[model samples]
Target: MSEKTNQPLRICMISYRSNPHSGGQGVYIRNLAKALCELGHEVDVLAGPPDPLLEGAARLIPVETLDLYNPEALFRTPRLDELKDPVNLMEWIGTSTMGYPEPFTFGFRAVRHLKDQLHKYDIIHDNQSLSYGIEKLSRKIPTVATIHHPMTVDRRLAVRSVRAPWKKFKHLRWYSFIGMQKRVSRKLPKIITVSEFSKKDIAREYAIDPSRFSVVPNGISTELFHPMPAIPREPGRLIVTNSADMPLKGLYHLLEALHRVSLTHSVRLTVIGKAKEKGGIEKLIKKLNIAHLIDFTGRIDHHQFVREYAKASIAVVPSLYEGFGLPVGEAMATATPVISTTGGALPEVAGDAALLVPPGNSNALAKAICSLLDDPEKRKQLGAAGYNRVHEHFTWKNAAEKTVETYREVIRDYR
Candidate 1:
């Protein structure tokens, strides 16, 4: 059933840290690869620490590195046998100095892996580990990268959120990976991103031509995120699935809006992610005296998360910026009315289905929540509209088709 490509492409997807439980990129690789394989294309995923949660037939090629950020064991004790390589010692030193050497190291490992199997693959698709060694791989094979968004946005926001000057400086130092990404991005022939907003932002941030980028919006897992008709809806409860402690997620702003909403309305906020102990969100909830009104569901499974979405009267996405807001689409897939902010690519995802408000404006968020809370008809309408929008515009099958096309294009051009 493989469509007639110029040639059969053995495509490999690369990810630095592909933990489905933790972040969006891992979910993207898993879903996209599975979709591609269903279309009769051969797909393999090359990944680093926290291995991917992939489906059938798609091979997961894990390249083990020192998972330095392991919560239980911060610094992994190196085996004397493993330490025989001087390069490993160098890597350890490089990482110890607070430099993010993993991406570069992973790229080196990937290049070595590909050296023996270079003839097998027609193209190499990178999942945002834009390292110097990655640029080297492009020299050998046609390479395409998917930049979800510029990391500079996260860097800038993290720096801004840090109250202490030293902490801000350390944040800036830690985000030095941007320098490598910017340099390597300009040389790449084709780049994929989830939104037009991301395309423009990446162009400016990396000083690359906007035309070089392709906007392929991410698809929601409609099957998994669909409405559970058996689960009864919870009235006056709002749901939002954002990383609570991250300033970039705008959880503090959502909390502020929730505080205002609690003054007159008896509503509760169920945040899907946990607020870190002594983190900003925990501090703010105490400050606003809305600790009783907010509920934190720390990293629940997909079934439970979707059930929560189905039960809630409405969902809110109060992110400061999103390259592609998955929660909005997921909420919509469950037929939940959404109130999302027009931050970064959020509007692109929310469209006319959800009520859009300006980012960082708690008053506007509170007003939107109040309006949805007041009118059942409006909520129902929005929910239906959102579901329709997601069904029509975003689908995993479509994303896989376009990605397959891109692979063929890159391979043909490589020849």
Candidate 2:
């Protein structure tokens, strides 16, 4: 590809489900699209519900689908007219069978949308929605995929966390989409992952050669997650941002550590997200009898989320594994001392800025939290170090630039 032809190439970015409040994928799409646009690229985000809030984008083309997972109408059957569409029928059947249909159905819809519009864009970038439809779309256009981490890891963790025969079977069925992801990923020319750990894991899990993968670390939104020094920090206040019921997130382990810490220290634990209703986390909170000492804030807006970090004395990330730990970066960006697990890419993101603990080890988490809580000077030192690391290494502009380089490579290979 000519250097001038690569400059300001039209890009089409696809995300199956992208709501910033829902997870990190939304944040990744919003920030990356904005940053790419700022670099003189025409970008379009084609996504399914809930809609991703993108600012200064070329356009947000909503790829409609059967949003069966909508909280307000969870599992509601699709209308007769909608079911007439083969993709909608597939989604209905898949969801009815306890399988996630978004990735598959979204790809089907996306491919249909992009088929005729293929001439408008230079490259098609898929954000982890590895599906058969994407494989079909890729054959027609220059395409690359981002597999955050193998969903197989999540499935193994979730299945191992549960003991009941039926529940284990359900876990297996729910993650049946991993098979599709594996197949689609291997067929693609290039795969982009957020961390080196993810690149290794994806290669091994999908049996793909490591040479086909590119490692691009995710960026911390410094604009929103930056330090708020004017906001007074609350001593003995510990914060963790996670989806409480996701077994991979290891919230149960964190709760166990909180129980251990509260016995010796007067610490108040605040969870930034809610626990699944009647899920393992809720049951564990009751079983451990630490409900009184913990607070679940459900979901808060970005502004409030940053302030929450500013108010906290320390942040903890207790995930069993992460493709890239966004909470660790966000907490560090906010200048809060962090205690995180060496889970997957947490160490990659945290480096030496945050205290590290073993994954699924409550005692280690408790010790790190206590050590940081007791030493205000140490906390201050770590906070400053983390802020500097974020400013130096993790920025949306850098991530976008690296991503465009990969896009150019993929486009050149396709031709």
Candidate 3:
């Protein structure tokens, strides 16, 4: 074992799929790796497609998979040569059966690659790829995993979102990988979660002891998400960063609130995501007759996203539940007052900086947005408060330092 010294530690971080545009996992990996490198540590990110966008001291190692979920191909069959690998074959079969296979297959490939080079790093940190292969890796190396939140929450919410038995069954099939995650999580010695709320929920859901967990709150990239004073804020223009049709994101409630608010006010909504053509969100939009009042920006770069937040009168996070509520912190970091539901760790992230509303309540959300829009003074106060709150509690530097501490502790115990 290498002795601890003033020298920086070599760390390897793994994520199954890390595309910043796809979701927060990519953002987390990109920023966290940058921060860790800034702290004088060497960091390498091993990820599958779509590749994560990383900078600073971090190096990206592409762990190629079948990538059956690529939007361009959209379930295109794999070539016969690719199917020679058992992991690739499994991934193709799993996707064919409507089950997510990235975690399992990615872990298999990652472990195989790392086995021969285990001596190159002092510790391994996994970004929620809780697979049996990870369990096998942990037995040989000092490994720690970050479970953002239990996928069981997503499964439960998705199952409840649809009424038809077939859709619910499909939801169950898609989340079958959760069974593997649950089994693997219990065997790992250290687990890092983003909030106290998530830590508790994961412990209960996975039936693991709370002592195995560490609550390290995620940080917003202040350099990117900070206020753009040059961009004039638009009055009566509400903005939300949602996953379109995901039930856990609570976009349905936000649309309903938009409908209610637009009845008497001249409010227009800009969604920072695209909706499926025939998905639940699109159907709801047409049914509620609010298609003309909303604009979906599809996917935008980080610069455009920050500008969008700066231009909005207010930012809303209407999630049914969140593991950390990165969107809430990002909006707050941009000096935009937020109206967020007290779902999961949202209130924890929002603190006293945001107007809290009940989850799945369109009426409450509408009222809160209207109240903020009508009172510019209140918006100013909340916005400033939120900015201060983020500066004090959430920063990449802080998260990286705390995460390194956990890494050191794990390394020492393993030795």
Candidate 4:
């Protein structure tokens, strides 16, 4: 970092999609933007559909696209007028062909939107939208990217989960954007990732040298996720935040564990996200006859999320892989005991504060859940430990400081 550059920076942050209040990525945008603003930096977030809803001095620069994947009208064909823009045509074509081109289209749109405004910012931070247009931005200005985790991990998991050759092909097609991301990632001068595990994995998968990476662990919002001691934890009430059908989330394994545990002891699961009607998850729940044992809370705001965590006996993160396990950190921030699988960087987030189980092992998950449920004292201890751990190690203040350091490094290297 340049010692002379002590003044706050004008930072432009970009993300192809920020899912508002849900998902780790949305939480990431909202918290990171607010924290950076609080740190005295002039931060402007350029984000795509559903709005990042960033708070504080940070500003939102809406980068609108076709928004083809919006749930309300998912994959609807663009009108002829809308398709006049080459980018919109490309987006519709990609979606119609079973490929996800949001990041690519978003980058194109963002670059066009930012071209006239580029001189107003000191640095640009690209949030995993490793598109060709993003690479173009790097040549004109100092640019950095944050690859939360290797998309290869998600692609591989999705492909492996399907047995049908055609289904496998579709999974490959949907994740074709990974190729563009990999190529563009190599062109960036700096890459910020969420965990040491993801840093190494992304470095290898994207074929970039590890030296180009900076590992900045994400911060959990203590205000929204903090413990409500007034709320009584319900025994056997487990909570998980995930789209039930996503293979990478490992919700199937969690459901299996829930079924097994319910055979001996009465237990219920509260999934924070909804399942598609008659989707894979709904079918599986019917097949396992555990539909009665689980409930979905659909979309929820921060207050509801905190209340859900507080009321649960334990929070669970069943992801088969994560760059950084946000669910675990959130639960810890809420002083909720957590049971997570040792997949990817989950163990790193949980540390010694939560019970660990092997990924894809329903039997192991069941055993761990049973043990925790049977011992309230152990649950209470783990909850407190997790709370302390998050406060000490995973606050946004620490993350923003490190992030600014990375920003300064990029600026200096560009200079």
Which lDDT tens digits does candidate 4 get at residues 289-402? 998898899888879889999899989898899999999999999999999999999998999999999999999999999999999999999999999999999988788999
Q: State the TM-score for model 2.
A: 0.98
lDDT of each: 0.85, 0.89, 0.91, 0.90
| lDDT for residue 22 in candidate 2, whole number 0-100 | 50
Off by over 4 Å in 3: none
Q: Clashing pairs in model 3? A: none
Give a tens-digit lDDT track for model 3, residues 346-400.
9999999999999999999999988888999999999999999999999999999
Clashing pairs in 1: none
Candidate 2 C-alpha lDDT tens digits along 1-415: 2346557889899999988765778889999999999899999999998988888755799988888988889999789999999889989999999998789888888978987898888888999999888899888889999888889999999899888999999999999988899888999999999999998998999999999998999998888888888999998999988855888998888999999999899989888878888888889889999899888887788888888898999999999999999999999999999999999999999999999999999999999988888899999999999999999999999999999999988888888
The C-alpha TM-scores of every prediction are: 0.95, 0.98, 0.98, 0.98
lDDT of 1: 0.85
1-415 per-residue lDDT for model 1 (tens digits):
1235744557878887787755668889988988888877788898877868788678988887767766668777677776676556656766677766677677777877777887777678999989877899898888999999999999999999989998888888778778888898889889999999999999998899987888888998888879788888788999988755878888889889998888888899888878888877888888999989988887688888888888899999999899998888888999999999999999998899999999988999999999999999999999999999999999988998888778777766777
| Span of 10 residues, lowest total lDDT, candidate 3 | 1-10
Error of 2 at 212 (Å): 0.8
Better candidate by lDDT, 1 or 3: 3
